[model samples]
Target: MIRKLAFLIILVGLGFAGVGGWQLWHGSVKQHETMKKAQALTVTKKDPVKYKDWDPIKGETIGILYIPRLDKKLGIVEGTSPDQLEKGVGHYKSSALPGKNDQVVLSGHRDTVFRHFGEIQKGDDISVDLPYGTYTYVVDHMKIVDKDDRTIIHSTKPKEELVLTTCYPFSYIGDAPKRYIIYAYPKKK
Candidate 1:
């Protein structure tokens, strides 16, 4: 009986290992392909409107985001989604655009969407290439605000800046109460 039980346990362990290995292999392959496609994207320069003026990203598409500290370079999307964020970028309607008014707020997933975001540090370089031009920003600060903190997401400052948001505590299994927010200012156009 002991031999049979031990043998069963070993088999189960091996099965688990196989499953884990397969998942890791699959994830790496998918990210590699995504990186290839993202790298081939056509990037645009940042178009800066006058301080009080406004202009949305042409084509309503942000090609990609390059962060030196992150493990992956994500592709930006027009809409928010696990799929879109997983690739590297997402859109938030309420936030302003490159040269638009208010904060250029955007949303992304913590682990899958903007996974490398967890590695972002103050002063890190964040380069966003829009249809009009490339907008560069530097990480200034980060905080975990509650979901009700609409004021953070509802900024209307007439300047070039970026506010990136995602659920907090990267590995949190349940609905997150606080949000992980990164504040960056436009460093270059």
Candidate 2:
């Protein structure tokens, strides 16, 4: 009877590991595909007048976020839903896009696309490449706030700001209680 119980426990453990592995593999595939699509959408020159009226649906890759310090470039999707984030970093649908002279908000899972988010710091250069143009931003500051903080999404009107958010306690295994917010402003020419 003890042998049977041990076997059952091992089986269950293997089952969980298999599921976790599969999820990680699936997420990697989705991220790769999303990045490919985003790269295709990027243009060589800035053409604000070309895609000015472009609108993307949820899960659609809208741009590429470049973190110079991290040497990372992640695709940016249209919405912050789980499905969208599974593919790439999510851009809050209601937030303004680059060159809009307003706040642009982005979010990503702590374990995946933003795994090294904690390594980012003030003064780092971040850039977003869209079909219309490539906008560079310099990290201005960072803060930790409750997960429910609504002020994190407010408009910066007349100023083009980029805000990146990820779950805090980067080492935490589950949903984090707080959020790590990175505030950046457009890099002047």
Candidate 3:
């Protein structure tokens, strides 16, 4: 019985490993292809009035985000739904878009798309490719907060900021209780 149990455990472990490996490989490939496409995209200048009238559908590809520090690229979807997150990062619909006012909030699954987020530094550059134009942001700070923290989402003052959120302890398995927040501001000339 003990030998059979051991064999079963090994099988389960192997299954998990296979799935994890496939996810990593597939996500990386998709990101690379997406990044190439993003670089070639061109859009009109962003106008605040046009954004206000825009309607977004869940799971729709909204933009592309590139983090030069991590050499990572990911597609930004419209909503933070489970299905959307599986493909890439999700943009908070309530927040402003890339070239608009207020904070543009983006969220991603830590184990997958945001695995290298922990390595980001204050001076790192992050670029967003939107339907309007490409905007660049420089990381300013990072913080860990409770999962339920509302301060991360709500802005206090009028500012053009980009906020990236993911599960804390980037490598943690299962549902993480804490949130990791990266605050970035528009790059200055």
**Could you estimate the TM-score for every candidate?**
0.67, 0.96, 0.83
Candidate 2: global Cα-lDDT?
A: 0.92
* Per-residue alpha-carbon lDDT of candidate 3 for residues 71-158, written as tens digits (9 for 90 to 100): 9778787888776677688898888787666789999998888987899999999999877678899999999999889878875247
**Best-to-worst lDDT order:** 2, 3, 1
Best by lDDT: 2
Segments of candidate 3 deviating more than 4 angstroms: 18-52
Clashing pairs in 2: none
Candidate 1 C-alpha lDDT tens digits along 1-189: 999999999999999999978865665554455555555544433334432343333223455677778744566655555554444456675576665646887777665656656788999988776545566889999998887788786665766668888988788876877888999997853
Worst 10-residue lDDT window for candidate 2 reads 43-52
Q: Cα deviation of 35 in candidate 3 (Å)?
A: 5.7
lDDT of 3: 0.82
Off by over 4 Å in 2: none
* lDDT per residue as tens, model 2, 99-160: 88999999999999999899998999999999888899999999999999988998889988
Order of the predicted models by TM-score, top scorer first: 2, 3, 1
lDDT of each: 0.68, 0.92, 0.82
lDDT of 1: 0.68
TM-score preference between candidates 1 and 3, better one: 3
